[model samples]
Target: MSSTTPQASTTTDARRSFLSGFGKFTLSATAVALLAGRDRLALVGSAEAKTAGNDVTILNAALAAEQEAIAAYQVGATSGLLQKPVLDLAVQFQGHHKEHATALATTVKKLGGTPVAAKAKYTFPVEKLKTQADVLGFAAELERGAVSAYLGAIPILDDRELAKVAASILGDEAMHWAVLRQALGQPPVPSAFVS
Candidate 1:
């Protein structure tokens, strides 16, 4: 994805216009991904009934986190505090989140469980931000949480195929964190991610 350089002076009209367009673009992209996801699941055979419920529960938790990541990106994209490039990156990350959510939801359905719909309201680790830096910081944090969540689930999953899927998605989440860090002008990978 290409990044746009921030304009010399961003006006209220410019920010509003960009946000409106961005929202429409994101919603459309999410819809397409969901449709593709349903198609993909039709090809995979169902797992054993005994293990299916456990797999579905784990996947549902990950799906919830993916939904939260999507929400976080939406906030960053429409906040108007970020430059176009940064906002575009936020949208890109949101797209990945949607893909992950769809992939997991597909898995849950294949396993014979109802896919959980993410809550409309979620609690973000980062509170309201007073500056652009704060927003990017929150984005980075969300990506990291997603990365950890996927990694933790990968090892415990009984299904090897789903484990592979989680591995791939976790890798993408790691990349999202790096991109978010770069956007914030922080080290792409921190020396120590946590204390």
Candidate 2:
């Protein structure tokens, strides 16, 4: 024979095999990332995964909202618009937000889901926040939103332990709300409660 050449059919089969192996590897890597809670890109890569369930979606949403509060409080504490007392309290609220986020992530992991990442951007509802009073008012509103969201989640959570944790966090959020209101010159207790 003058010359011998590899069959085109063999080369095509090898290419297909390599592509199949790569597909499997990609799928495996994605699964591992989702399990490790590092695949928010992959988890949210599919809009279907993002809207899969009410409880899981709500937990993800709450994590985002709590993280927003934590970031806002941190900014307020360092912005010099707040007095030391307000700054200190803002730090405390930031701690609570972290705790809440940790608890939610733990629960989500235990339930065989990945915790959503905190959003890098958030919009605070405080067009009037210009002074210390305004900052405290903004904090109070954030806490109120957290408390209400937790209360709403309590009944929806299928896990009893998760519900209890939400209840505990709700109590802390309520306390933060009360403290913020007090610092903003409102009575510590509702006027109707004591009178």
Candidate 3:
């Protein structure tokens, strides 16, 4: 009976260890699946479906904001107010907005939704671009708007990965705003916190 007791104890320990290892493996596999774009909630297909729908709506709104930013930059770049160097910078900022739009569109499609297209004509203050200062001021306002939109999106997005993406874009938009503000002879860091 003494030998049997030791054997039983060893068997129980081995079983516990096996369960621990198996649980770790399962968790790791789930993480990998999520990173690979497999929606875990979609596997069950009920509650998560609604969350996915909400995510699609938020992502489409973000895409539209990006499109608007791109249009604003295009107007500023072509207004004949910016010098060569400033125009180059405007184009660069526009490219960033385009990249954001592309990523948002891709994510929207991945969520089974169509992206909102840019309007045929956006009502930007094109007539207000009378000088370099005016152009920079307009671009700065648009960048600030982009920053606000992305900042708002970070909390609304259901997916952590999507929130991370929005945070990244927020950083980029904030930088654009700061630079444009400096160009407009305003304090770049207007406040300690952007809130």
Q: Can you write out model 3's per-residue Cα lDDT over 28-102, one digit (the tens) per residue? A: 233334435833444647677777778889989988988878767766665567898888898788777777777
Best-performing candidate as measured by TM-score: 3
- Candidate ranking under lDDT, highest first, comes to 3, 1, 2
Predicted candidate 2: what Cα RMSD to the true structure? 19.5
Q: Looking at model 1, how many pairs of residues clash? A: 0
Q: Rank the candidates by TM-score, best first.
A: 3, 1, 2
* Pairs in steric clash, model 3: none
lDDT score at residue 179, model 2, on the 0-100 scale: 90
Compared with the true structure, what per-residue lDDT tens digits does model 2 show for residues 51-152?
334457667778878767766775566546787866777866776677677666654664447798766555554345568887788788788788788877
Highest lDDT model number: 3
Deviation in Å, model 3, residue 138 alpha carbon: 0.7
Q: Alpha carbon lDDT of residue 49, candidate 2? A: 46
Error of 3 at 147 (Å): 1.1
